[model samples]
Target chain A: DAGVTQSPTHLIKTRGQQVTLRCSPKSGHDTVCWYQQALGQGPQFIFQYYEEEERQRGNFPDRFSGHQFPNYSSELNVNALLLGDSALYLCASSLDLIQETQYFGPGTRLLVL
Target chain B: AQTVTQSQPEMSVQEAETVTLSCTYDTSENNYYLFWYKQPPSRQMILVIRQEAYKQQNATENRFSVNFQKAAKSFSLKISDSQLGDTAMYFCAFITFVGSQGNLIFGKGTKLSVKP
Candidate 1:
């Protein structure tokens, strides 16, 4: 079976620009979550989507948002990006909203100038 | 809020040797879950092992095992017969059961280097 997959392996953007990262969750999974991993640091949770609605969110600012399609694919959008936004964006998917175990994707690398 | 801490910033072990990575977490919830994820140079967060709070027995997967002291809020990962492939950054993560959909809180990570 296919595991979680993400698009746009790498992206380059300037401050104030917006970027969207895509994710295709693992087969048989329904919940999707986003995370940001800065250089030399572990991933920090962004938000989680279930039933096409955000069910839980981290301490991220409003500039970060996400969407989950019926097929369980997800998109992470960052607007008015800052230099700190340059990091690896990871996508994870679980079997359901209640399942705590999540399978993660390789992640998309974003560089903000 | 929950926090995961990995005390060792870097660790090294010779091939075929054993290494242990330490982790501690702070949480008020009685029921939760802990995990150890391995991220190689490719940067894929691969699940190494997981331990449920309520389960008294420690979790083990092949050569990887965890020493989970729930009462002390400590979780340490022990890698046996380490190989070159085991050289990577290992992160400890936690998630509480209070919020069914709560996301994982990861530690800063410990970089493990296996010398051949």
Candidate 2:
């Protein structure tokens, strides 16, 4: 019974560069959502993926995008990264949209230089 | 839009003692859900407890319990016989279903430290 897992526990990128973070949702889960947690702040919703299509998105710019594979794994891509993009990227998965209890991964720490 | 607020930025409790963290949220919807998540130094977000707005009885998970006042829009977590392992950043979150979508909102968080 593996829980939600994220790849590249940490990442470093430069301004104007692009980066991709990966997430494998918990077993028996289908919906994946991404969140950004800045230093000394709570996580802000990025977007959510369900049925291989983006269902909802937050206030993030177009530079932030994501995809969900058929296996329920997800990838978050950020382009033209800015120093402010540096934060902890958290991936949460729930059984379904109606089930609000989301299990989160350890998160990937992004550091933009 | 809904917002959750944790008034206490930090708090401390003696080992084996009890501590309560306060949270207040703003929402106009009638049906919703509230949650308390614990994030340790390791950075893994763990769900502590949850409360459904329609339920009158407070939700309790062993040593963890919540005081949910729907009219006051308040949800507070009480940790009994606190342990060192309980030290972590606690976040209050809200979820509500509107139309065909659901929204999850989180508060800044309250850092709790249990001193031995």
Docking quality (DockQ) for each candidate:
0.85, 0.82
Q: Per-residue lDDT tens digits of candidate 1, residues B32-112?
A: 889999999998999999999999999999999999998899999999999999999999999886657577999999999
Instruction: State the lDDT of candidate 1 residue by residue for A17-60, as single tens digits.
Output: 99999999999999999999999999999999999999989889
Model 2 lDDT tens row, A65-98: 9999999999999999999999999999999877
Chain A TM-score of model 1 comes to: 0.98
Error of 1 at A89 (Å): 0.4
Clash pairs for candidate 1:
none
**Among these predicted structures, which one has the highest DockQ?**
1
lDDT of 2 at B20: 99
Span of 10 residues, lowest total lDDT, candidate 2 chain B: B95-104
lDDT of 2 at B84: 98
Of candidate 1 chain A, the 10-residue stretch with the lowest lDDT total is: A93-102
Error of 1 at A34 (Å): 0.3
Structural similarity to truth (TM-score) of each candidate:
0.98, 0.99
